[model samples]
Target: MDQPRGVESAPVQQLLNLLVDRLDSAEQRGSAGVKSIALGERTWPALYMAHRESEKENLWEHIIELSCWGWLVVKPEVATRSRSGYADSPRVTVANILEVRKAVGRSTRIKSAVERWREAVREGLHGTDEVKAAVSEFCIDMPDRSMAEVVERLNVLPSLVGKELLLREVSSQLFWGMSKVLDKRQGLVAAVLGVDECPFPESPIQLQVFLPESGYHGVLFIENLMCFERAIRSKSSAFDGLALVYASGYKGGAQRLRTHDGCSLFYSTRGGFRQDLRASFEAWLFSKDVIPAFFWGDLDWSGMRILSVMRTTFLELAAWEPGYCQMLAALIGGNGHAPEAADKQGQKALDFSGCFYADTYLLPALHSYKKFVDQEQIRF
Candidate 1:
C-alpha cells in the first residue's frame, strides 16, 4: 500500500494556498463587507470553516496564528437560538470574506499615511521659532488701552509681524488709553485755574468761584466742552461785567470741568441741569444780575434744545452762534445739503414765537438746505 498522506500536511498546504489567493482577490476588489461581519459583526468562524471536517483541523487556531503574523484575520462568530426558534446565523459569504480582507489592508495604509502627515506638520512648526514666539506673546493678556494709542503703538512694530497678534497683545493697553482720554476731557472744566484738583462741597448746589479780585462775583455756566474751553480761556473777557460768583458745567464738555482752587464746578450728570442744583444756580444768577448772558453750542437740533433749557432758567440768555438768522445766513452762503424736518413734537416746539435764533434761522435753513452742520465743522 502506498504510504498514506499525513493528515495535516497536504490539506494544510492547500488551505494556506487558498487563503492567500482569497486575500489577494479581496485586496483587488477593495470591499469591507467581510471585515464588517468578522471584526465589526464578529462572524469569523462562519467565514473560515468550509465543511465540518475543517473544524477538526483547528482552522481557527491557524487563522489566529496568521493574524499574529500580520495577516488581516476575522473574529470568531458566536451563535444563539431565540424563543421564536430562529437561529442567530452569522454571514459567511465569499464576497463578505474578501471585502473584510481588503478593508483591513486599506485601514493599515490609511493609518500610516496619517502618521506621515502629522510628522511633517510637527517639523514645519519647529522650523519657524520667531513666528511661534510672536504668536505666544500676542496671545498673552494685557491691560486695555484706547484705539488711538493702540494704533500709534502698533505702527511702531515690524511690518513682518502679524497685525491680529499685535492687536490681541495690546488690547488692554488700548482700552486704558481710551479711559485716559475721557478722563482728560472730563478734567477740562476743573483744570481751569487749577480748580479741578481742589476739594468740592458735600451739597450739589454749592457755588464757588476763583477770580483775580477778591470781591468779584458772577454766574458762569458752560453748555459744552469746546465752548467751555473758549470761555475758561477767556474768563476775564467773558465774565468781566458780572460779579463772577457762580460757575457751572453742562452736557458733554461741561460735565468734565474740574472744581479746584476756589471755583466750584457744578455739572449735569444726564442732559438737563441737576434738579437739586438747578433752582440754586438760577437764584444765584438772578441775585448776581447775570442776565443777557452769552450761550454757545453746536448748530444742530440737539443744540437748540439745550439753549431752550437754559432759556427756561434765564430769560435773558442769548445764543452765540446757534442764533436763528445767523445760522440761516451761514447755511445759505455754503453749498451744503438741507436739514431734515423736525418731528411733530419738535415742529410744534419750533412754531413757538419765542423760539431761539436757531428756531427762526437755523431750523428754516436746515429745512431748505437739507443739511446738518456740527460745531466742529464750523471750526475749520
Candidate 2:
C-alpha cells in the first residue's frame, strides 16, 4: 500500500512552491492572478476568478488549504448574485481585492515617508518652514483628526509634526513613534582660552596657544569637543608658565584672543590648509626657540590623521598625554589605557613598529595589544 500524503508530501510541496513563486511574481509586478495551476477549463476560470477577486494570493496557505480540501467549488447562490454584489463577476471582486491591496500599498508608502522625515529631524532640518509646508501639502486628503492625532502623539519637537502629518496624509505610520532614538553627536571640538580670543581663519587648521603669567607658552590644538572642555577646566601647573591659544570651531573665541597683547589666533577652514596661512603658522611655531610645543587630540583614527597634518607645520612638536604611553601614565596614573591597534589601513600607512612620531606611535602601541587613551580619560 502507498503511504498517505500529508502537507509535507512532494506533490503538495511542489504545489505550495508553485503557488509561492506565482504569488511572488504577481507581487513584484504589482498585480494579482494565478496562471500556473493545472485544472479543467471550468475549474480554471473559477479559480482565476477566486484568485483575482480575493487578492489574497500571497496568503497561499489559506488558498492552498481550500484548494486541497476541494472547497473551492463555486456555489449556486454565488452564481445567482449579480456581478455588482458580494459573489459577483471576477472584475467586480478584483476591484474589491484591489481596494485592500491599495490600502496595504498606501500603508507601506506612508512608512517609507515617515522614515525619511525622521532622518531629516535627526539632522536638525525638521524645524524649517519648507518642511512644514511640504507636510501640509502632502497630507491634504488625510482625515483631519486621524492625521492630527498622529502628529500630536509623536514626542518629537514641534518641527517633526509636519513630517508626521505628511506621513499620516499618505496613510503611512511606518516610521511612527521612532523619532526619539536618533543619534545627535556633534564631532567638532570646543575650547575656551583664558585670554579673550585668537585670530584663527575660518579654515580646518586651528593652532591655539595658551600663555600664563609666567610667560611659558602652552601651544596646542584639539579636534574633540569634550576633551577640550575638560582640559581648560583643569588648569595644570604645567600650563602655568605658558601662553596658551586654542584653535576652536568658532570664530568668536579666536577673535577674542587677538585682543590680548602677546597671544595670537589661528582660525580653522573647512578646506584643510591654505599656503599663506600655513607659512605664517609655521613661522610662528619656529619663532620661539626655547619653548616646547605640544599637540593633543583623541586616540581615534581621525585624531591621528590630524596629528599627521600638524607634523608638516611643527618640526619639534611631540604628542601630549594620551598620545604616548609615558605621558599618559604620568597624567592619568596606572589607570590609563592604550588604544587598540590602528585599523588595517592605518597600520599599513604607519608601520607601528618602525616609528615613534605622534601618528606612527598609535599603530605600534595598538599592535602590541595596547588600548588608545582618550584625552578625556586623563584627570586634571
Candidate 3:
C-alpha cells in the first residue's frame, strides 16, 4: 500500500506490504478476473497469519484506518465465536484482490528468472536433485550470475576453478547451508561436465581416539564437539574401550571413508596421539571388528536424521543409548529449549532413526515435549 500521508507507521506498512504481496500472488494465479478473495480460505492462510501478527503489534486499528480512508477495501469485521466457543472474535476479510494489487503497482505477471531458467534447461536439468536445486537457486537468487556462462565453463569445473568451483560459483550460502548437495549429487556435476567424478574439496576424517591399552572395542561418533569433548573428559566406564570420533556435521561425506585415501585421519601430533599410531587407527577403523558403531548427538530432529544418514554407511550403527537416554531424561524433566531457540526451526520431526532406542524413546520424547536438549547438557 502507498505510504498514506500522516498515517503510515512501520508495522502498518510492513503488514500492508505483506498483504499486498499475498494478494498480488493470488492475482498472478488468475485472481485478477475474480472479484473478492476470502481472507480465511486455505489458499490465503498467509493473509490471516499476517493479520494475526499485525494484531499482536497493535497495528490492525491503523490498517482499519487505511481501509476507511479508501486506501484499500477491507470488508467490515464479521463477529465470530472463538475456538473455545465463548469469546467474540472478528474476522477481517479482503474485499478485493485487484484493488490491493493496484495499490502496490504490480502490473501484468512476468515470468521470474527461475521460471525462465527452468524453461531454457528443460531436459538438461533432469540429471540430479542437487544440480536442479543449485541451478534454480543460482538463477533466482543470483541476479548477476549467468547459468549459461557456468554451463559453458562446466568443462573446466575441477581443473581450472578447483574442485569446489561448481558449489563456490553457485552460491556460498547454499554450499554451507546444504553442504551435502555436492557430496550426494557429484555424479550429476560429473555427467554434465563429462568427467568420471567431480573432484570436490574434502575435509580430512577427524577422530578423537580413546582406545584403551587392550585396544578399542567399538566406535562412537559424536555430532557436536561440546558433547564429544565432554564424553572424553567424563571418564565414564560406559565409554571405556570406545574410540570417539567427532562427526563435525558432515552427513553424506562421512560415507567417503570407503574411498582410497578417504580415511586420511586428522590428529594433533603434539598431543598424546603419535604420528606412528595413525596407520593402526586407520586399520582398526577399516577392520571387520569395527562393529557396535554408535552415534550420539542432540535430541533434535536433525540429530536423528544424522543418525539415519550415518546408518547408510554403517548399517550396524545405532543411537548411543546412554547419551541419548540422558538427553531424553532432561527433555522429560523440562530442561530443554524450543526448536527456534537452538536455530533448529527448519528441522522436521522425523519419526525414525533406523535404531530402536531413537525411534521408540528419543523421537517420542522430542515429539511429546516439542523441545530439544543438547547432548552437552548431560555431563555423564
Which wins on lDDT, candidate 1 or candidate 3? 3
What would the per-residue lDDT of candidate 3 be over residues 1-380, giving only the tens digit for each residue?
55444344554445445666566566556565433334343433333455355443343445455556555554433322112111123334445545544555554456566666654454454445555555454342234556454344343433444434434343243333344435445554555544576555454455555544445557788888877667667657887767777757754226656444445555533223644444456665665336578888878888888888888888888999888887888888899999889888998889877888888888888888999998778787
State each candidate's clash count: 48, 42, 0
Which candidate number maximizes TM-score?
3
Candidates in order have lDDT scores of 0.38, 0.39, 0.59
Ranking by TM-score: 3, 2, 1
Candidate 1 TM-score, C-alpha based: 0.29
Per residue, candidate 2 scores C-alpha lDDT tens digits across 163-278 of 42322222233234332211110010001111232222222233443333333344555555665555555566644443344554323223223233324444333222455544
Per-residue lDDT for 132-242 in model 1, tens only? Answer: 333222211224533233324333333323334322233224344332321222232122113443122212233433232322233444444554444334534544543
Single out the weakest 10-residue window by summed lDDT for candidate 2. Answer: 185-194
**Residue 299 lDDT in candidate 2:** 52
Q: What is the lDDT of residue 83 in candidate 2?
A: 36
Better by lDDT, candidate 3 or 2: 3
